[model samples]
Target: MSLWALAWTLVFVATAMGLSMWRRLGLEKDMLIAAVRATVQLMAIGYVLKFVFRVDHAALTSAMVLLMSAVAADNASRRGQRLAGRFWRVWMAVMSTEIVTLGFLLASRVIPFQPAYVIPISGMIIGNAMVASALFLNRLRGEAQARRDEMMVLLTLGATPRQASRHVVKAAVKASMIPTIDSTKTMGLVQLPGMMTGQIIAGADPIQAVRYQLLIVFALIASAAFTTMVLGALTYGRLFNEYLQPVV
Candidate 1:
């Protein structure tokens, strides 16, 4: 669409803010901030991506991907600020997820090893991994806090930290993965995914768009599961002291 067309889209944002005001939902400030922030971020990234796509250097592309992963990990780590080494755990989980997912895609020749293909897909995978890690960490921390008494009893019975917190770890991992799993199951019936819809709007064949969307859907499932599982395993031990007793 043209800039004029894009400008018209602000009407929707205005309507949202209007509704927030009318309902006294107390979200007007947040909605306004988000709208402005999204616009600025997207425009900046649009220029950056345009330049990167033009350059198309392998090292540059890889650096861009790393920057994205680092940003994602940092954002995810915010959800568990009190968890020791949370940022590194999130960074490791997200980076590993990106490597595994992209490795398969490149090795299988499902997508070409170029900025056009790698950058967008990496963004999606990294973002999903970030959400998964954040959810797992947040839930893990919550579960550990809530079940400290139970875990203390298990500790007293000679259970190790992992054994004492096994249930909490499992629950947190499962919680983190539930959204991705549910979205995959309900993809077409519940909502048309953004990638597929964008492709079709850009005049790509619907079938081809569907195929790419399927690849994304499958990758997201793996990304979310792997990120949550890895992060949960790495982080659950933090809930306990060196003496194997639950910590506050």
Candidate 2:
């Protein structure tokens, strides 16, 4: 689409603002901010990606991936305000998830080690990991707070910190992963994924688009699961102190 066509998309944002005003939802300010922020961020990324694609250097590609991971970690860490060492915990989770998934894809030759493919795929993986980590942290904190008495009872019954918090951790991980798993299950039937839709729009074969989308879907599931599990394990320990008492 041309700039003119893209400019027309603001009508949707205007509609959202109008609705917010009509219903007295008090979201007009947020809606305007989000729209402007999205536009600026996307335009900036587009330019940055253009430069990266032109350079096509492995070092530059790796740096871009690291930058994305760091930013994602920062964003996810905000959701864990009550958790100790939130930034490092989320940074470790996102970095580990990206390394494992990207390493396997490169080593297996499933995707070539090029900026064009690596940057976009890594962005998707890192983004999904960020969301998963945030969800896990939020759910775990809520569950721990809601079930504090149950955890205390287990602690009084000679349960170790890990054992007492096991149920909450499991539930949080499962809750965090459900969205990714469910989305994958409904890919073709309910919705055409963005990757596949983009490929098709760019004139790629439909079948080939499906294959690439499938790879992404699978990668997202693995990334989400790994991130949630890692974050849950690292975080649950923080909820208890040396005396096996609930600190959160």
Best by TM-score: 1
Writing each residue's lDDT as its tens digit, candidate 1 over 52-85 gives 9999999999999999999998999999777888
TM-score of 1: 0.94
Candidate 1 segments exceeding 4 Å error: 21-29
Give the per-residue lDDT of model 2 (tens digit) for 1-248.
89999999999999999999999999999999999999999999999999999999999999999899999989999986888898889989998999999899999999999999999999999999999998998899888988899999999999988889998999999999999999988889999999899999999999999998889998999999999888887788999888888988
Clash pairs for candidate 1: none
Off by over 4 Å in 2: 15-30
RMSD of each: 1.7, 1.9
Structure candidate 2, residue pairs in collision: none
Assess each prediction's global lDDT (C-alpha) against the native.
Answer: 0.92, 0.92
Give me the displacement of residue 69 in model 2, in angstroms: 1.1
Candidate 2 whole-model C-alpha lDDT, 0 to 1: 0.92
